[model samples]
Target chain A: MKRIKSKTAIVAIVFSLAGPLSAGESLPIRNCTWCHGSSAQGFSTAPRLAGQREKYIENQLLSFSAHIRDNPLSQQYMWGATANLSPEAMRDFAAYFSSLPPKAANDGDPQLAAQGRAIYELGIAEANVAACLVCHGPNAEGIREIPRLGGLSHAYLKRRLEQWGQGFHAAAEPMPQITRALSPNEIDALASYLSFVAYESLE
Target chain B: MKVIGLRLALPAAVLALVLSAPSRADEMGGPGFSSQELRAKLDYCKTCHGLSGQGYRGYFPMPRLAGQQPKYLENQLRAFYERRRSNPVMANVAHALSPSMVAALAAHFKDLNTNPIGGAPKEPVALGKTIYELGLPEANIPACSACHGPEAKGQGEIPRLAGQLFPYTVKTLGNWSKERGQGPAKDDTSFIMAATTHNLTQAQVAAIAAYVGSLR
Candidate 1:
């Protein structure tokens, strides 16, 4: 009797550790967490989904399935992930991930942060670069369909910016044109600066 | 000897006229800008203002310059430059523009007639139309059509209200006194709107903004 009770308690602990999955026809969140990390904070090349704009994530999922976001990593990973998702599933995932609190990566070069801040705030007007704050919001919190940029990983942000200039993700308007104007050093500065920014600190 | 001097004087006079003609033209239009320079500048403007100058909704709503009166556009640019308008970005942009470049840009934008990028709430539209067409007599407001023309196309220094962005109009009307006529010198036109803006309630302003924004 004692052995049987211990066995039942162990099983219960294991089940609780796994957490409860959402009821209904939606895909298991583990399918995304395997690559996105258990916390949805992101891992490797996958970006942090937590605290991202819900509409932006939903739009990107649709873009992936449609083959519009054709960057190499997206093709290799997100395309398959989003391929068979229903509209409701997409909305559910977007709402779920975006609701999670985000932590700043804080992974940038301290020396270059000031230059990056200046570029982000005011832009290099002489070079015809429009200020990022005009579209990205003052604290980089994003609005409506725009994605939050403050706490995304440096590598991910850098890759995305570079991809725009490389002719991938051509459908994201104004970005292709905007990124084309940024030099490699400027891209580094921007990505580095953004990685270190804590969204809460600014708020 | 008189004939010899007359021949010398005639060539000198002709040469002087030929040399001064280009400079006089430059004086009239400010300085000459190459087509390439003008095109580049226009693209820069479009980055903030929409591609067709139709206006854009960024974190801040950029106003439509397309089909606007060149005089009004020029006056605003001058206002930005003179610190009469308190927009840091526009001040930076306006400061870089030569008078001829400003004229070229104004002319270029004035020719672009595009549809309004509409996104305002629909409920207030009818009320907006009424307010735009007929002023509230008890509130001492005059009909907007009186100055903006029946179609809101505006004349001289008055801006074209047709197809202006909803948020841009709202922000402009709400902050009229704070943002405009800010320089040491008085701006007569901006002053005229100050009393009118002060009198209208927030709802009335939204109605007018919505009505005008819906116009093509």
Candidate 2:
């Protein structure tokens, strides 16, 4: 896996140098694909960009550029990456990434999935947690500006949920409030359930 | 020994009275929820319905409850619980709420006043205003103002349309029959809308939605 990652990084670097001449697109795909993985399926800390809602991706890019999405990792990497990008370039990137087919991360604890599904669908009314499906969709295939939550990596999902609770991304409305209602255990369950969800199951 | 027994009896009677007071208050139509519970539930509701009950646009548009008629809100909550309304999300939400909680929530939303989260097109507003004030006689449409009031502030079981989300109103009006009055028993209030919702053309629906959505 380490060897393959290094090879991917080398190829990404090569492509970054030769990309503009061959593709005619000024925005370098390597800039995102470097950490997001060759297929944009997400590596380690970086989230999967593939099959994300176009508007959501665009909005996030704008947020990152404005430094509104101030999570540690975002500030460390995405802030500089999006700083120089124009609106058209952001839209193009969003369109390109959103068109790619997504694959489920499938790297979460299977035992917790049922509990997560319950939280996702019905919510814990006693705890005052709102049903995620109300806005995220039944299958978690988000619409318009809502980010698709299905098939994301457990680590990425968990970190993001935790960050919202920690008050990192204050600009994302309702998320901080929503995550505040979630306990550490609930977050684990949610992240686990979402990781194994395949987008094709919607059919 | 007699004095000690009498003192014990007095204390026991006071304890019983204190314990019974909450149930008695519930029987008298007071809110079953504590202030904290009510606040938490309201926050849960605002998570999708907008922080100020101005409504929100999500995967499905959550309707504005701000300044809505308490009677209408209560009836809708009942409809959801009874399966008269076909919304699965609302059904689950309504199922969790007791009658007193429903009443309390409705009353809370009834007092909220917020501006519309405007996104409707400006072009068809004139046509919308015309239809709102004076219905198309040829189409058998009565003026919305006739029932919803000139200011669009509804009374009793009639819902207030002022400051409602444009997309939400459009979707609700468009799929009224499909979403509402789904139970074995008939819903009288929803029945009145059956004809009105059916008669309006797509363009007319957009116009009316745009107009009411812009109302303060």
TM-scores, each model vs. reference: 0.85, 0.85
Q: How good is the docking of model 1, by CAPRI class?
A: incorrect
lDDT of 1 at A1: 90
- Superposed model 1: Cα runs more than 4 Å off: A1-27, B1-32
Winner by lDDT: 2
Task: State how far residue B167 of model 1 sits from its true place (Å).
Answer: 1.6
Compared to the true structure, candidate 1 yields what TM-score? 0.85
* Model 2, docking class: acceptable
Residue A17 in model 1: lDDT: 38
lDDT of 1 by residue, B1-216 (tens): 533343244235434533455553343344666554655567678777886799888878989998999899999999999989898778877878888888877876776789999998788989888878888878898889889989999888889999999999999998878999998886547888988768899999899999999999
Q: How accurate locally is residue A39 in candidate 1, as Cα lDDT from 0 to 100? A: 76
